[model samples]
Target: MDEQTATEAMDNFTAIWNTYTLEGEVVHWLACSLYAACRKGSTPTVGKGLMEGNCVSLTRILRSSKLSLIQFFSKMRKWADMSNLSQDFRLRMDRLERNFEVSTVIFRKFEPIFMDMFQNPQGAEPPRQPRSRKHRRLPCHISDVFKFCWTLFVYTKGLPPLYRADGHVSSDEPPPCVLERLCELHDGLVVEAKGIKQHYFKPYIQKLFQKQILKGHEELLTEMLDPQNFIDNNKAINREYEEYVLTVGDFDERVFLGADADEEIGTPRKIIQEMTTSQTAAQSQLQQHVEKSGSLAPSTPLTGRVYLKEKDLLVTPVSSATQSVGRLQSMVAGLRTAPSDHLMQIFKSCSRDPTESILARVKTLGQTFKEHYTNDSDDTPGAHIEILYYKILENVIVQETKRLHGRDMSVLLEQDIFHCSLMACCLEVVLFSY
Candidate 1:
């Protein structure tokens, strides 16, 4: 408004215009125009800032020149680097600079638009995080299905007959009774994973390939092998998967080993016959006693009969007792006929929910404590304690950033197997003391 200041501003603009070429002037004019919009409180529409010789058309003219692109970015960075701008503005500017250097096309297309937004933000507010890439592998579908079956077998302390083919199951179905029982005791050792094929190991990986973020399949299989990614992920997914394999996976193995006590080449027919006889005898005894009398004899003289009948008859009738015996026998028979295989344990651990009941709660708690330091909350005492109960996975990315880092891009890639392995280890350490 003052004569001298107006003259000085005009002189400065003229000097800048004369010194730079038509292309360079574009960046300068665009920067100035954007800065003015902020100062004058103008709404930022993409069309508002474009002028006859502004940065927009300047970029179009030099579409074929890499030098022009570089120079334009340089000017953009200089403008963003201005000290008078707010810290949040500075970050957007910095990101713009990085975008240009790393993602040239994206930088060119969006930088100006973003710059306008910063100039006239919808309201005076703090900036939010920009979208970034996620690099953890997820459990595959088959792996998830297997883990669920293993969990069912372990929970029941044996493979149900419906899940078995013959008197003996193979290594792929339910393990031997000893193994199944063991799995129940250490079902905490059984871990699970899901979304591996889609979350981490998706069917298509063209984006990762284009970004040069992945390598060989073997390397992808072991992406969580690094320690740094482990720590960061420790607070996130790495801890979860590590807990699964360690707690859930281990339990499955224990059950398999325990269920199959006799590792001899073959089970003799005599032994099978003896086992069957014993089972039948137990069933017969329980049934006979339960069915002895539909209801206590009207004049039965047992000392406690009168009192027992009065208290128990309401909920459990004599006929119910006989039925219960039969149900128990059926359960036993089903257990006896269940499979004895362990091959699908890996797959099973990848799918099912790890924190379903009381046992799963304990399993998860143990896993969480293993990775991160226990939560410190007196009021919400067992808040994080839930984390310790069931086996929850924590995924992490451990990159080899130093000597052998770059040679293996696989470390940078994602994979479910590696994620679960790390999570299993963490859970095991946390749950089982040392």
Candidate 2:
């Protein structure tokens, strides 16, 4: 063949290979292409014998058998002979021959039928015709449904930080709103296509959860939920605060005093006395000027320096109850609503006793608070709200435990039931956030 014909033949072969590769039968289809090219005498310079040798080499590389190639070639020869007498083939060939690019046109025309034959190489019986039935069942299996759910869960859980901004699986899990809609779709499909109950596959799903596909992820889940982790995180913040204070406190004190202690060549007492004398002398000078001016002129309030006495800077200690109440009030301010007002009232009433009735009331109010605030927006409540809700619940549980066990057994409040309730509440909040 000339250069143009050879290039066109290669392009046609490539297209055929690509289409067959999608169906996972590239080697067989390639052998058929070689057979067709040779039979049509398309590659004139590259004779049939050399083409057969190339096919043998390719089949070996592709791990196909010579016998299969030979059989495929025989089938192609038979098809070509029949094409001469077949009116449909004759008509298509005549129409394609009208094109100047006859080689590509012929290849494209026959490639589909050749692919069909290759797909059913054994010449199996044709598929059964569709029956006219009122209902048709979906081909989905129980395993397939479970696999999809598990795959979705794993994909979301394992997403890199770029994809998961919040980065906690519980918080990052697919939203319940979205999942509910998906389940609705699933139910519709089940009923319409399979003629089954909406929840016919519920048992399988339950079993999957019971099996815990995330079985080995206990450590990660615990790390995410552990209260001690939060406590340690707070402690880290406090440590950083202390370090900052120590580093900057002396410098601030020196700047406020208007003289660096190291620059003054004197004992500590002498330096203090000198600073005091200068301040008194300056005040006296100002008084004399004011008296001379005959009227008290407004002053600029000493520009920048902040004067501090040792007594004025003392830290006052606050009781834990006052602190807790103040924190709770601040948290409640985030939700400016009637439900929040009701919650604050309930919190105040439960402060003294926190009885079972009071605890139940708080629980009911919490659910109401979430419903009222979360129903209208995609955004969850701020972290402060979630933390405060759990903290109050923890305190109430502790108080009830202490009331039942007596003051001597107050330490027992942190054990058993208290821990479990706190964990459960944390998990619920995490899931609710998602």
Candidate 3:
């Protein structure tokens, strides 16, 4: 193989070896030897051949090692299978690759902000004194390392020749044990780093919430729950809805146009104009009524309203339109006042017994995982379970922080929660894998 192909082959081999082998040093040496053999066009024996090779060749090159070559190659073969990689890793890699270009640009644009956040966890100001060596050594600021490893893991996973274009595992691909091993090692390292981060960053995270960096607790909470922001968000959502309506309108128009190709195009234009005029007249009447009553009348029509049904297009009735408007207004009003009430309830609950509420939430999530995913053979339950656990834990932490500090502490809570959950998950995986 040429240099590029040899390098690629080595990468693939490392990923497989890492995925399967627990002993890093032994696997590393074995993989290097195998890669070198492959580079020189001497293929490594795999599967049955590896297992049964001793009977055929007593002088086999790898037989001198303390570890059986047969067992090593057999394990390598199993791990080399593209399907052996975890579903979560595969999906993450796929997503990363799909957005690789966009993510690169976005990361570059926000690089300074990211660096600042990492270097100065306090956000607003630097610490007066330098942190202790132990604190400085924490992996809390190594999010980028995890990200890079995840990407590499995905890339290496794909490098296995067994991966088919249609996503089926091919039996004929050459096993590259070294690359697989390396990828697995990277995965373990990243997981361990995250655990370190979670352990060390908890106190700093709490301090940040206590400090209330950018704004006071109430101000931050109010800003987060502001109805005005909700309204602005709705405006963007409404634009998407309008676009959808226009698309559907065009589709309907095409259907009608197709049925009567001989009909003048101007006919549809005239019909649209008439509809617009009627809508405008109704709006004018509704405005006059609202002006007289100093509020919307019960029967006032909303302007430019159209509803698409399964088989037909319908104009909204004045009373129905008015009711819709009232419902929306009520919802918006409820949104404006709901946050404070919810926060107060959470505060009360936290004051009574914060741990109880947290435990209850965790229990609920566990039950949900069992009920929803335990019997679903198509889904991998571990990733989903981890996600649910993380979300619940984060919410609990956020609520607890807000209750104690009397403000939204989500800005700092988020980073801390992520690291903590990740560490917990890594520990869980280690326990289960053994």
Question: Which model is ahead, 2 or 3, in terms of TM-score?
Answer: 2
Model 2, 6-102: lDDT tens digits are 4544665676545432222444445444434432332213342322111122222213323232244344344345333346434433442333133
Give candidate 2's whole-model lDDT. Answer: 0.37
For model 3, state the Cα shift of residue 277 in Å.
Answer: 99
Provide the RMSD of all predictions against the true structure, rounded to 1 decimal. 34.9, 41.4, 34.4
User: What ranking of all candidate models by lDDT puts the best one first?
Assistant: 3, 2, 1
| TM accuracy, model 1 | 0.17
lDDT of 1 by residue, 1-434 (tens): 23443354345445555654333344344544333223223223366562221112222223322223345445545543332446765665455445334433322333233333233221233333345686544322322222322332233222123422223212343222232333344332322212222233222232233333332243233342243332332233323333332322111221221223123111211111123568989877767766875543433466465465465445556666556545433433322111112212322333442213323433454446534755545322232223321222211212232223224323222344544454455445333331
Higher TM-score: candidate 1 or 2? 1
Per-candidate local distance difference test: 0.34, 0.37, 0.38
Q: Provide the lowest-lDDT 10-residue window in model 2.
A: 248-257
TM-score of each: 0.17, 0.16, 0.14
Question: Which model, 1 or 2, shows the larger lDDT?
Answer: 2
